[model samples]
Target: DQQVKQNSPSLSVQEGRISILNCDYTNSMFDYFLWYKKYPAEGPTFLISISSIKDKNEDGRFTVFLNKSAKHLSLHIVPSQPGDSAVYFCATQRGGSEKLVFGKGTKLTVNP
Candidate 1:
């Protein structure tokens, strides 16, 4: 069974708009939530993350919010740009585990 899920396979947004990507998980024991962005023909790169203990974490225009009670998390990008277009994956890891479970990914297109 897939532990993490990205309901939307793709999303489109106009340039400079705020983009929101959603993720859900079945495992409540996940201690960390991570978001990765992948460009074409490249490996996914770490984007933002939030610990289960915290509700939100932010870096530049990227922010990740975790809702433990709902087993849900979201990644938000403000002023979304064309360069931000990529496949975004939602991942989770346990406190002491190196193994990461990732969602299939959501393709984001920021139209210029």
Candidate 2:
């Protein structure tokens, strides 16, 4: 089963706070991991990604950490803004292709 799991259905945080989203996977063959941010009815857009070989990757206010041994990963957004309120999906790519298997998604609400 190629399933990525995001246990939390939603998260709420105050502005300028940190928003952390967690995800888990059962497949060990997955080598690439990605995080996508979505708003409303629009499609998810790429946020950040980390390979199995690395433990941490960061881009500006977004950071993603991966732990292959535990088959877990997390996304951290520091100083969250109102604009950060959206659905965050954790995805994984198996083998070589870029096709991704997504989690249920976590809705992040950053209150101003």
TM-score list, all predictions: 0.98, 0.96
Poorest lDDT segment (10 consecutive residues) of candidate 1: 44-53
What would the per-residue lDDT of candidate 2 be over residues 1-112, giving only the tens digit for each residue?
5489999999999999999999999999999999999999898999999999999999999999999999999999998999999999999998877688999999999999
Judged by lDDT against the true structure, how good is candidate 2? 0.95
Deviation in angstroms for 60 in model 1?
0.8
lDDT of 1 by residue, 43-87 (tens): 999998888889999999999988899999999999899999999
> In model 2, what is the error at residue 51, expressed in angstroms?
0.6
Off by over 4 Å in 2: none
> What lDDT would each prediction earn against the true structure?
0.96, 0.95
Clash pairs, model 2 backbone? none
